[model samples]
Target: MVALKSGLKIRKLAATLLLLGSSCIALELHTDPAVAVDPVDAVCSNRMTLSVTGNLKVPYCSNKILDQPDLSVQRAVIVIHGTSRNADDYYQYMEDAAKKAGKLDGTIILAPQFLREEDIESRNPGNDVLFWTNDGWKEGDSSLSTSSNPRPAQVSSYDVVNFMMAKLANRNVFPNLQTIVIAGHSAGGQFTNRFAAGSQEPIVESTVIPMRYIVANPSSYLYMDEKRRVAGTVDKFAIPTAQEKSNCPNYNEYKYGLEKLNSYMQNIGVNKIRSQYAQRQVVYLLGEQDTDPNADSLDKDCPAMLQGKQRFERGTIFYNYLQQYYGSTIQGNHTKVTVPGVAHSGRDMFNSDQGIQQIFGSSPNHHLNHPTQPTYPTSTSNS
Candidate 1:
């Protein structure tokens, strides 16, 4: 009996010890390393992807804070690439400028690819699916190139401009918007000139909206007439008084694509600028050296820009007409900027510090809510 009690007591003590041991144990779980996170670092990695021309490209610009723009920044400057289709490179250059100016977010810089033939085309990209057709300004997925079969609902290249204007008009789209600038180079410049003169869209005529254009370094300029200089020194008479805006709805060659399609002009129910189109704000930017004897040489027979001492010199003649005789008569202002020592390149004075202020430069002027506050300085840019 004594042995049995002793054994029972011993067993009881052992059980108690085991229970206490189990209760005192502390458990710790190990987690995956990835579970340890930092919020700031995650935001730093966040990036936006922009796809243009059916190809995915990363604007991939620096995340540095952009410019703190005022109401003046309510503008969209759309740039069109030349025959080289070097939109990407041109975009990068503008991006760098924007970054420097700190207006990266304030301004919307859009560059489109105007694809041309292999003879006129070069090493840059030209194969992406087009988002727009140069045809009469349709909106939405552009129809396949005529060279392409069974077109995909033909949309006009002008459609993009229309779409952009709508986006700007909606405060929801750009709350801080005030002006819109359409800019292009080389062939792109050609598009700007013709479209400004004969846009199939309505925004071209709306005076309430501040719309502007910058045509840079185009080989061919839409001449007001066949006027040249008197021995490259003084202004002679304008050739035939060939008014640009007066002649409209004639595709010239754009009709090949614009024929029987949606146009900004057609949508507004007018056939000519005199009937419907308003005098648009236009600026011409040129390289002082792009005066190739064949620079403005589209054809020799009919000349808006005749054989002159310098290409720039000839361009100055057009600028003078639009400003002195033309724009002033209609109360519209035209800007002319000459690039010193630069030839056929994208970096012109207009896109520079002196030029940005020249182009978009405005101080805190009085006379609120009027065009007077942001008066543009008089420029002598001829070509």
Candidate 2:
């Protein structure tokens, strides 16, 4: 009996050492400037293998291992990248935000990269790594399979997030973890908004870990209904006219209004999705000066134009629609925050005092103060 107890104690000591070593590796990755360069066809060094049926893996930059138990970590922030697929840059942005908020040591920052076929071609990450089409990842579409690099199984980007949350929910892994924040900007904003609507919220709910979503300057949003802001009006919403419908037939389709959902979203079904999203804690972070309708990266598709003119307008209108649609259901659950003097930049959006508060829940250097109304500036040419 004494020998068996000694053996168990030895195993416990080894596990503790493993956790400590993992934490140190994560800290080194965050502080190392050489590994945190601007992302241009770059993949993060750490790859998180999903606990799914197949041998699937996704590249990510994190300040802590998902499976390791770390008592110091109280919060987890998953920052998604935009159309550029620059997860490293987004990771650094959130890391800097956490530092500024004085929550660096207690926060686990993760930036998962959703690679494309072209990105795979440039880097040639192994066949087990999943690659999506150009816009597939943005809309929760399945990973692609090509003749050269056959994917073992088709996985949705949302499924990857579900798996991550499941890992974090493990009591043995994150006993002290209290919150999870999923944030994104631009195209990443689109992903966050849609994913929040369709994600398996019950996974974390069972563990009582509260989750919040921070959606920054996205070109469009996932409208829960067919109603849209009437043209030439700021707050008025109506179903598209017959002529408008004729011109833009698919305006209410998948990404825009849920007429057709991707495989992941379809499984969740529209009724459950709308109900869950209305009850979620979300903050729409918009930039005051992002008013240029002709900005190079703005989505000019008919469905997007149906939302609003530009990023700022689109966000404001959508929030207003949510208020009118959900009524008392979303009183304290949802909100809109606008960063003054900022325009279409992820760094500016995530580092502002308001952004820091939303990302870290609270900031030591600043107090949380959200403007009651969004202030828009005159149109200016800015990306």
Question: Residue 96, candidate 2: how far off, in angstroms?
Answer: 0.4
- Which stretches of model 1 miss by more than 4 angstroms? 1-73, 116-128, 131-144, 147-149, 200-209, 224-234, 238-271, 274-278, 294-311, 323-327, 363-383
Per-residue CA lDDT of model 1 for 99-131, tens digit only, reads 666676667665544332231122222233332
Cand. 1 TM to true fold: 0.56
User: lDDT of model 1 at residue 93?
Assistant: 56
Worst 10 residues of 2 by lDDT: 374-383
Model 2 TM-score on a 0 to 1 scale: 0.83
Worst 10 residues of 1 by lDDT: 33-42
